[model samples]
Target chain A: GAGVSQSPRYKVAKRGQDVALRCDPISGHVSLFWYQQALGQGPEFLTYFQNEAQLDKSGLPSDRFFAERPEGSVSTLKIQRTQQEDSAVYLCASSFDRSSYEQYFGPGTRLTVT
Target chain B: AQSVTQLDSHVSVSEGTPVLLRCNYSSSYSPSLFWYVQHPNKGLQLLLKYTSAATLVKGINGFEAEFKKSETSFHLTKPSAHMSDAAEYFCVVRGPYSGGYNKLIFGAGTRLAVHP
Candidate 1:
């Protein structure tokens, strides 16, 4: 009955540092996704995970962005050498199956790169 | 590629008045449409969805949306809006070209305000 959850609801990082955001998908959810939204902009796709497999990463802005879903249930989005432009609300969502097109979103991690 | 467009950046209405939030979508194939609402400091919540099942889809909190293929629209509406309806609304679309994943493309959200 629990919904998707993200950790460090707010994170502040200095430029050139590294930061990792965590997502805990709903119980038994097989599909996971990550999104980023800048001020006054809609959310943009970042990556997707089917179980433990990283299916799509095309939306990742640069090589500095990396994601992993090692055990298929939890995921992490890591940004290396964080830049000021990376500041935004990082959202995570999960669905039950491939056909479960409706995704349940988390509170989102508000990341600030100073 | 699939995309969504929100017609308005903001919508305001008095309590008990009809609510309308317009949205347009683009997809190469039959699209699956959805409406999501987000309260400040909270997660996004699904209001309703329209697959191939019906032209008009009803969702929670007395909200509904009509899917018009010809107009490329899936606008959300309610017979009477409550003060609590004030929030940010998003229109999303999932096209048929997904490679085993449901990539929901979202529109610029519309901020709704309700007045007493």
Candidate 2:
């Protein structure tokens, strides 16, 4: 029984650098969500996917953020021209069916922009 | 617009004492409420959820919450506080999604501290 997995538990990048965070959802999970959590704050939604289609991305902060799930099972969140305010923990979650509301989360990738 | 409000930013209790974490929500319609916990350096773990099945929902670790439509409240409570119970708790509300998708709206969160 495997849960969601995120790559590079921790990453440090320069303010203007580009960074990519990867997420592997549970096998066969049809729903995937990405969120950003700042220090001492609750997680805010970033984007979501159903299979290979990008369903919603209204939560992405700005144009610097981009996400893709081309294969339907794995998703990636990329930040270009990263800024200091972009530092936070990126979380990924997956659920068995789109109809089911419960979501299981991964450990998350902590990104620090210096 | 749907949002959750955790009344207290932090709650401290002595071991063996009762624990209470308050949450209030606002939604256009009946919403599914959830409680999630996160330990230090760990990911979020679901404690329980209210999916309109029952007004009073029971969760893991002997915790429970009663949904009050009148008060718009879903406060979490436990019989007693344990050291292991100290963690950050988030109150979440599930939002209706398009194309049969479901999304969660999260609260700011409440930090719990247990002292022996």
Candidate 3:
């Protein structure tokens, strides 16, 4: 069985540009989440998805952040007008169900805004 | 609301010695506690989880944690430290969120270093 996976393990972007991070959750996972990890800090929640619906986006720092999981299996987090403060590791996780406690995580995409 | 605190920013121990990583949590409801390990350039791996099934939870790689509601603690421990154990450990708590889903809140994390 395969675990969650993320693409572009590392990304370097210039300020004012837009960047997109991809996440492939385990097959049949009913819940998906995104988090951000800054240097020497714990991961902070960003957004969540249940099936094809974006259930929560309150954690998104600003309107510049957008996420989509149209098909319900894969997700993408897009940041518009990237800023230095947005530089961090973007982590994606998935669970068997919304009630399940165990969340399998991906390797994450480390974004650097220069 | 739920939050976790890793008592120590870092802990260093010699190989073969006992290891302890302390964590405390605050939550409005019954919390689901977990310990996750992260190696350099790797994904977060679940070490163990406490979902009220047991007070003492055993996880992979001979690691375990005890959930104490009175102390509000779920500390991770290993009988003997191994050099391979050097990495970052996080204490996480899952609590109710909007839409009937649980949100995971993580601690700042503890960096453990094992020296031989």
Candidate 4:
């Protein structure tokens, strides 16, 4: 019984560079979510996916942020032109379905933009 | 817009002492409230949830929370604090339903320190 998993536990990037973060949701989990946690702040919702569709992206900070889940099991969050403000921990979560309230989280990827 | 407030930014207690982390929330409708804990460099773990079914909710590791609609609060408590309980705690509320799903709104978080 594996939980949600994310790649690139830590990443350092130069300003204006592009970065992609990956998330592997638990098996059979049809609902996935992404969140961003800034230093000393609570995590904020970034986007959500149900199956292969991107249902919500209202919390995405800017046009540079894009996410995709082509096969529904794995998702990726891509940020173009990395900026200092983009430095934060990116978390991924998954649940059995859209109605499930409990969400299992991944360890998260910490992105540092210099 | 729904929101949550963790009253204390930090709480320090001696081991075996009672622990209390206060939270307040505002929402347009009856909300789903939750408590999550995050250890250093670890993923967030659910402590408990109150979905309007019962006012008092019990969760893992001897944690519990009481939801009081009159006070607009969902405060987490433990009879006795443990050294392992030293970590960050978050109060959360489910956002407005949309497109068959809802997102989670998190409070700024309360860091607990347990000293023996």
Top-TM-score structure, candidate number: 4
lDDT digits (tens) for residues B1-116 of candidate 4: 89999999999999999999999999989999999999998999999999989899999999999999999999999999999999999999999989988789999999999999
Judged by TM-score relative to the true structure, which candidate is superior, 1 or 3?
3
Q: Is candidate 1 or candidate 2 better by DockQ?
A: 2
Give the CA lDDT, 0 to 100, for residue A48 in model 4.
Answer: 98
| Docking outcome class, model 1 | medium
- Which residue segments of model 1 deviate by more than 4 Å? none
| Cα lDDT of model 4 by residue, A20-89, tens digit | 9999999999999999999999999999999999999999999999999999999999999999999999
Model 3 chain B lowest lDDT segment of ten: B95-104
For B1-116, candidate 2 gives per-residue lDDT tens digits of 88999999999999999999999999999999999999987889999999899899999999999999999999999999999999999999998767788888899999999999
lDDT of 1 by residue, B1-116 (tens): 78999999999999999999999999888888899999999999999998889899999999999999999999999999999999999999874546698777889999999999
State which candidate has the highest lDDT: 4
Write model 1 residue lDDT over A1-114, tens digit each, in one string: 888889999999999999999999999999999999898777888999999999889899999999999999999999999999999999999999877787899999999999
Top candidate on DockQ is 3
Docking class of 4: high
Pick by TM-score: 1 or 4, better one? 4
DockQ of each: 0.79, 0.82, 0.89, 0.85
Global lDDT of each model?
0.92, 0.95, 0.95, 0.96
Model 3 ranges with Cα > 4 A deviation: none
C-alpha lDDT of residue A93 in model 1? 94
**What global local distance difference test value does model 2 have?**
0.95
User: How accurate locally is residue A112 in candidate 3, as Cα lDDT from 0 to 100?
Assistant: 98
